[model samples]
Target chain A: MKQGPLDLSQHFLEEGVVDLSSSEKQSALEELCAITSKHAHVRDAKAFCKAIFEREKLVSTGIGLGVAIPHVKIPSVTDYVITVGRSEAGIDFDAIDGQPVRLVFMIAASEKQTAEFVRVLASIVKLVKQNDVRSRLLEASMPNEFCSILREASR
Target chain B: MNARTLVDHIRSSAATGRLLILCVIIGAIAGVFCVAFSWLLETVQYYLLDGLAHHESEHPVWIWLLVLPAFGGLVSGVLTTKFAPEAAGPGTDAAVDAYHHHGGRVRTRVPFIKMITAAVTLGTGGSAGREGPLTQIGGGIGSFVATGLRLSNQERRILMAAGMAAGIGAMFHAPLAGALFAAEILYREMDLEHEVIVPSFIASIIAYSIYAQKAGWEPVYAAPHFHFRNALQLLAYAALAIVLAASATLFTRLWRVVRDAFSSLPVPTALKPAIGGLIAGSIGVFVPDALGTGHHLLAGAFASSFSIGFLILLVTAKMVTTSLTIGSGASGGKLGPSLVLGGSLGSIVGLVVQDLFPSLEIDAGAFVVVGMAGFFAAAANTPISTIIMVSELTGNYQLLVPSMLVCVLAYLFVSRHGIYDAQLVSRLEAPSKMGNMLGAVLKTIAIRDAANHTRDLIVVPEAMSLRQIIDLYTSSEQLAFPMVDPDGKLTGMIEGRDIRRAIAEEGVADLVVARDLARPHEVIDIESTLLDAVQRMTLTGLEDLILVEAEDPTRPVGVLEHQEVLHAYDRKLMEK
Candidate 1:
């Protein structure tokens, strides 16, 4: 209940992380959104997935460094949330850098929770940019280990 | 003021200060040009008409007076039509149109072409003023200088106005009036282009001084000793205002009538001025006083030598001749004829008032000055310039009170109808003015200030059924609903538009899940500026964008609706 400097690792639950072999951008985004939907915070799975697809039509969220951030700020979110998916084969996301995205961070948050949402996104990007953090994240077998590595690097 | 110091100072100075210095230089150039133009016209007229044959003589060869103006008109028409067609008609209107619509860009050849055309037209006895051509020449110079330097649009517009003011100031030896004329002539209503006033005034003074050095420091006309006399004279001036206003209206209407008549004629467009010149030349030969700028006739009226009947005839003849000359596209101004008509009308009004009220010592000269100002105030919607210009031209500061009163009365009576059709309502209505205003506003504010907090919104679950979603959608006025999974992690969003589309489709009755039709929405960084958010929305064609944390691209914070951006803009405007 107490808000602090936002932690990116807090949003990544065990079920939120998944190994996705999907090559297409839309399917990868849908799988990530589905992973987040299983969390208690995700109130509407259909509405949430639709928002992500609609956002994709505008521009790809693939920010490069083998990372794609498909984010949505919707009224259906009760709190800030993020779903992490790792594809070793790399998904074909139309990123600005043009490299296939190996990591996808599908984030959804309540309309009012901008502070936490922004902080969480900044922490994730900072942690992911570290060569050690990225390599360890890819080597981690489970979502818990991936989240723990993120927590260590973010600190 | 040293040359080296001045150059260094200008290089280090700000844009506005640099522009003022440039205006002074432009004014000097314009002044020299105006004097040269006036001298050219006078010398040509003397050689062609006066020196060739005695204009006052009854010699049969003096019949050339009847054909000279027609020949001049033909030459002027050819010059205007061939090189710079925009130089045709009153040059002030063209200058005005350039400032309002053309970003103050006048063709380089316009000033030269107009000068030649106007000289020929007026030199050969065409009844029009040289003021219009000088104004265009000055404006052209300003446009040239500003364009050469690659100045901003706003700075260029100001310089153009300053150039026009310099021309009028130098031409008539009325620097203050000329400066005001440039600012006032841009609008038909009671509005001034105030930004140009200071630069224009500086330019006018510089130009006036240069012209005075060559032409001597004398007003354009000399008036007899005239006093305000008594309070009773105010009533007479008021009466003169009414007469001038009526005559001004009639003058404009007659000009239009003559022009329309010539336009509809079977003759070639270039030859129309020749025909007009023939009629005007015939009128001039009968009453030579009505020809040219009529400055001498105006001076004669102030001396109180003309009989009442002769003054009336001069007014009618001057009006008709001016209409014929300018209406045929001879490339001269209406200001000189307007002053002539107003002065003659005032002379008549003065005579009648003195005769009717025997006790009142109403000087006819005072009436003449007031009449000149009043008629132009109504006809050209230039009350301030008319008062100052008339007083300056005659060196009669004592007549200011009466001139102001008459000018106001006439200006009010004439309202929106004026001689310059290119004049707009105000600077506020100009496209360039609005663009500058809006651009300045958009630059000051950022997107962070306009964003709303995410805690203020309603969050919907991604598990909600379509029927339940429909019930909630129908119950509330919310346009967008953010979705989350069972573990409370954000997934996507559903908008009212998506729901409507689904309902319109067939075989979708059982497909009620909120996630099935969810679409991606644009995401904006919370740290991004408000202008960036607005630009993104415009670029992506979205009415709303989702705000995310700057550090974490995947995390959503709040929704920034288009209406909210507009509301912020409205608030900023109100503050302004």
Candidate 2:
């Protein structure tokens, strides 16, 4: 089968766009991983958090401008998946820009998905760099609104 | 050229004289190279980045900014690939790998190629630094001098480390730190190359003094004296350490990512650096401060002149551009860029903490300096030397407490894979040290270690006939059996070879008794090491040795197999 760029919007089921409840950085990650654990790609939320946090230790995915992308590659994951978590009151993520992170995009990829992983990483970095996309994502109130914003951005 | 020893070439009577004279000569030579390399780098960097860019400031010189770095990368890539392939990329790896794996012998032309390539790579606005490549250059100087003199491989490796220390010491103007760095950077853990320490110190101090005498003794960055005031504020420093550690991990991982990406590209190796340079130049067109060795950023950080936004931009841009510069196989070091990135992140952390607490009276510039130490400590996996190096770089000993604390915390927190690809986890893990460690470790284990296995021996009665002994040997797997007297006292031993000879004489199989076939055998004392037993077996052509008490050497109590001694060593090696 031929592989192409993943439609990030299509994967964003409204339920996957979680409103982060915790103020602390560790808990915020836990909340995202927990919410997305029900997906087929993520069988265990604890395991997902463990792998992603281990990677975070290697390098924080906190790209500057209030956005963070915590990602991991695990053998248990069958494919690639993206789970979004937004916080109104930003949490300290040790961001390169010294800004508190408000938007956390948690990505889980199968261990075999090397090329797809890079493409997904590039897409996320590029998508957040767009001023309108980032602003709309931050201001996004409802889960449906979040999905639409990503869909429009992906298009 | 094939002269294998210094004595062969020099015809010296005094070996001590030769070693001392060579040590001093290598240090002086390394010192001179450091000054020359620094001069060439400054001249070229000024021509491309500052001198030329400022001269054409009135026009749209952005094109020049883009072209200059790409051109620099192309020249460096071509030079290294054409002449000395080992001279390519961040140089510390080659130097370190040489000491561990290659017997410290650098190719004759690598040093010369590295110097020129590093100069062009760093000077023409590549976001890499001078120090990393300088290690290879200096190490080459040592290797070359030792090769010419025909020094032993061990002595040659020591000189190589000394040269590395000298180059780093001269460039940073931090002699003590450079000396320590030479020892510390070899391993990822908190271990040092103890043998290299004294030699590195001697070379480092000499190199630092010579460079200072020629280039002035001024510290690289000027800063106001910053002291640790509140013990409570160490919490803030800890936070800074975490941030620095995280950023350091980011720097190393991103560096690898970029390098892998560039290497994996289908283009010829000679042209990959140019592509990386083009992208980096485009970034430089907007944020010009991000290019080169980052002295400007270092200066700004020490002056406490950064807004959070500005510092953040510099940090991000510096990380990306520096990665591109070094990752694309352009010959330069990431150490200097790491210092800048760490300081920027630290400066921002300091600002935020000071604003949040207001009463802590936190000095933001202090964090910049501390960040420099902490970040390098984490990324390079050299904590102790980094603390001193940053202190010496800023000429401020007042912040030693904070610097040391931050460095250690960051070092402990960083990932196992640091910026250096060649660093081993410990001295034991290094191949150069393994051969010598084997015998020394085995000697520590006594025969008593395997005392439990002695109880399961097969004892042959002295009264038993040769036929009975032959039947027992055929049924059981014992190669040798302990022969005993009729009174059940241990006497001697009978091996398979003796049994075979006895049985070959036709009627003797039933005629000879166990006592007749028994031969007086070598015995090992309980106090002896496994090495001793094995050595005896090799010398006497014995398959097994009788174990005797050290106090009673006449009486044989149990048997010790050659295989058991070997098994003991195998278990011990695993522990080591």
Candidate 3:
């Protein structure tokens, strides 16, 4: 899925949020919302969690390769937004393996953006599976750098 | 104090805050303890075997074989009976049971007892590998640290994995393999985050460095330089994968047969290993290289000293010895022994192939290395770790492609199962019919008492109302409920949180029934294996399951809870 740089960048990054160490799902949802708001058009955390859970119910989205793609089709989200969060401290996402999740990619897309959304997801999966690309993405210093890496990896 | 104050106080209590810190400290302590245990065992084995090898240098190797194995078996039998009975069998099953059922709580003394007992077993020339005891020792150390630090159940489980990694790394001097070993073999997938990989790497490297510094580096096997000409050889390697896969299946089946046979015996359990040892010892008399863990024979094969005929004999003898040793209840490992056996088998195969086609020369040692990785991958169903391990062991990065191919093929070939059937069984949703039969026999013999006790006491009536469910929950302390419709059709489930949420949000007096709030989720089928249950639970993050008739999910038969299963397993261990 190839999307413009600005759109793809907005899909995955949020700025100025400190690292979270909380184990509660609500706290994680709040953190996710905060980060996602800076990138996409998310109204609130609850709506995001509901959308993600609905998607989860349809399919685990765990993907089984240590990566989980939690996305939502919500009208509140204006554009296709993907937010990537790395938990230095692991969070229990009820991951398929009963193991805590470290890296999370949350996708927010409108109903009309099916093809683009799928392509973006496929690109992310392919990039994440590559050791070099994932390492660079994980080590990106700021929102801009993270966005740049994602754009570069997508290409 | 008010309710808010009490809740805050409980959250900030010294006990709760310390649990997280305890987990980290436990991980570090466990790492150190695993190294110490491994070193201790190795030292004992070295000294004991050093004397025997020296004394037998002047005589025929056959005499030393009989004496060494007999002595090892006797010592193993005596130590198992006198001290730690738990140390008598492969430690992986115990570790797995403890992890799932005991909240990673293992007796601190178990590692020490296992270290000494396993050392005696190996030192006396028992035909078992050391990896099993190492895992138990590592797990015990992890438990010790967790208990000492008072970590939470979740953190303790992580520490258990870290400890296992450390032990495997130290034992084999393969840090990457050790780390992956913990993540892949025990967890059945790479569940830990990339961040945890750093700690696992650090622990494994530290432990392995300490071991290597003290013991010096010992190559797992030597390899003669072999040139790879074309993609054709890679195809040949792929063909060889079939052989490796078949061999791995045979090894696993043989091990199961031996275990089942011995467990079926009416005699005292303590005496079984002695009988096994006698069989292994007799084999060792004819094939001296089959004695002990056979690391020396592996080295010999790599150096091209062992002939094809001798390789055949060693492979057969080693397989039988290992099967008997483990079957008889001797606490040991199969990894090293399997590698040796696979290597020998590969060498023999390579020789026969080369003899048939003299023009197409193939290096036997190279085939041996490929065989080692392929067999391990097939038997363990861990292809990535197997490929990486063989590459690292041989220090031949060039072999990675062939190794990967063979490992993957072998894994595909044995896609049906693994040598560690208990591990596979544990991952299932319910025990198989064979497992049920075994469980029944164990119960009849009163051996089931040692297993962990699970209290699956909560039951829900088909006609219960939502108000009644709420009242029952408020009156009692149960956390889960099985919801059945008026006609006794399995509908869904309601948990403590579900009821509380419904009451808080919708009002308890709204006349909403349990059926209205019940969440219809997938019910675990009766025929589903225990491993399947665990995997599904893990995937869904469900703590309780509704057991329904296999033919129909609408018919509710019983309820199963994660805690109850864990308790039942604990009872099993206690009985043991």
Candidate 4:
């Protein structure tokens, strides 16, 4: 229910945090969609990937600080969802600061999910704004380590 | 030029070899349907109005006149509101809407429901026209027959127009004008639906012949022989055109205002029409000429017995009563009432002109005919067809020069405001012609050039209460509000749908803030191509409402509306 705050920790699955070997920004989005599409909320993985790429065409969602957050609100996305894909090589995301994106945070929300969608998005904004959050997230070598850092930082 | 030139009106216009045959079949059926509707209208009017109230007689029974239309409105209202709301208001607009938006699809039951309901509304003295109801009815027939034959969407739309032509041609007894009306009425500007012209002609001729065979080949109004020879008469005709243009504008605006007022009432939608009929009936108690479609008054105005003062009063009364009856969700058309309003006003102007030019032998009846054509031409944005339609309806072939001048003048004077709201600006903008939007134009324009710039942007503060946002939503036209944090940095955005969903889900608005309702909104850089924005908009099923920003997308600069992109694209194509 959108009336109450979303439990951020429960939504971040350890398996979803992947060390993505993507050469381009588009490939990075594909890798994240493949992982997120496996979740119960996404109706189709291929369509979701296509939608994310389409959203990227307008303007790069890569906010500064080596973080590219590509998000879409679509009918295919039945609930609030997120997946983290880290490209160690740092793909060029055309960010305003000209920083190569080391971390790709993908968000997918339902067309109708208002409160919970906004809550998840705002939490990500807060998490990305943390002083050392990106460096800590990039340095983590394993998926479980990445999850723990996110969980602890969020708490 | 010798007889009939099978000319290709447009380069891309569909080949009408098989379509012509279908038009013949559809036209025949639509013609018989028109005759049946006319007969039904007359039978009901004779029994109900003549028997119960003595409607047209001198010193008529008053109480019966007041109750009959209200009762008729109650029945017709329930029929349209309960079973077929598509039949509500003017039927011609619904028919045009279906052609342009609904892929030429009309539900199977709409025609049958419309026929019965429209007859009831007109027969019991509701101040509405037969054109709208019959157009929808005939259009439904065409849609049905075309769908049965497994036609394409384009073919179906063509057939639908043919049916419309048949209905108008048969009912108004003006076959050629009816065909032209069907094609011309679909667009507001000087443009016509060129593809529909020939097929409509075929259907209209067939329908008119069949109806004439049964109902006698007489024009609706018989006018005395009147000539327009004097050069001084142009002055009078021009003044008539200007006044008629003004009256047409007034009629269209009045219709919308009255329609909105009735819709805003808390009563059941079905009961609204009954209330409208009650008001019209009360007006009819003093002026019975306004109670029904004012066709008979047009005939009377041309005769010698009717005074100029009475004709002027009839014009005002007809405009008011027709606005009340049809605007309140009753099934009817504006075309028939417009004829009466224009005819009476023209007659009044003609008398005034005759007084001015006492030395010249001038015929006032010529103005009556030209006035009918001119008033409708401006009101409905159908100049060419209305001239021919009015001429044939009056059997007045001698006044073509005056009719043409008046119709064209009135059309130019009124410009774009007309009765049919569904009429598109031009063929380029019609939804039915989506294929005309070349894909190459999309790649030619940039977001910076096409995006809409607004000075009064409504930016919702993240800390602002959701209750405050709701108030903003009510007061402003902005669809998406950009949400800024305490530092005034763009954090997120709240779409119009987000607020609607929150209200639908019954979220506590007082407790939630703008931050709680804002989603991770998509923004486009000013450098993006129109094609890039369009691809995203279509794939995501979102509007062309992406925010435009500078180097940093979060720093919003403008809003890219899809309409502006389309306008730019259309302009580019025009340059080619």
**Tens-digit per-residue lDDT, A61-83, candidate 3:** 55433455666655566777666
C-alpha DockQ of every model: 0.02, 0.00, 0.01, 0.11
Q: Which ten residues in a row have the lowest lDDT in candidate 4 chain A?
A: A1-10
Judged by DockQ relative to the true structure, which candidate is superior, 1 or 3? 1
Alpha-carbon runs more than 4 Å astray in model 2: A1-155, B1-21, B55-60, B447-528, B532-562, B570-576
The value of fnat for model 1 is 0.00
Q: Top model by DockQ, which number? A: 4
TM-score of each: 0.69, 0.66, 0.55, 0.64
Taking the tens digit of each residue's C-alpha lDDT, what string does model 1 give over A1-155?
22233455555677777889687887888778888877777788899899788766555667678987777667787876777899999988987688998988787877555333444544565566677777888999886798787666655
- What's the candidate order when arranged by decreasing TM-score? 1, 2, 4, 3
TM-score pick, better of 2 and 3: 2
* Error at A91, model 2, angstroms: 99
Taking the tens digit of each residue's C-alpha lDDT, what string does model 2 give over B1-576? 566686575665465456556656767887888888888998897777767764124443687778888999999999988999888889998899998888889987987899999999878888888998878887888789888888888878888888899889888998899889989989999999988877788888888888888888998776757888889879999999999999999989999999999989999999988988899989988888887888777777766787999999989998999999889999998788888898898899999998998788898989999999999999999999999998889898989999989999999998878999998999989888875676677688888785443666678876576678889888876667887665666766777766665544443343245644566667789778877876788898787888878787656667776677777888987886
- Please rank every candidate by DockQ, starting with the best: 4, 1, 3, 2
Where is model 1 more than 4 Å wrong at Cα?
A1-155, B1-13, B52-62, B264-267, B436-576
Using TM-score, give the best candidate's number. 1
Report the Cα lDDT for candidate 3: 0.65
- Residue-wise lDDT of candidate 1 within B1-576, one digit each (tens)? 899999887776777788999998899889889888988898878877565534544452346668877988898888888898888878888999999999999999999999888998888888899888888999999999999999987888999999999999999899999999999999998888888999999999999999999998988886637768588778888888889988999998999899889879898767878889899989877787777778777777887788999998899999999999988888899888888889899999998997899688888877888888899999999998888999899898888899999999999887577888889987778877885666566557666677564666555665465566777778765566667666655566666666665444332222235554454557788767667776787786666777777676555677777777777888999997
Deviation in Å, model 1, residue B326 alpha carbon: 1.6
| CAPRI grade of model 4 | incorrect
Better of 1 and 4 by DockQ: 4
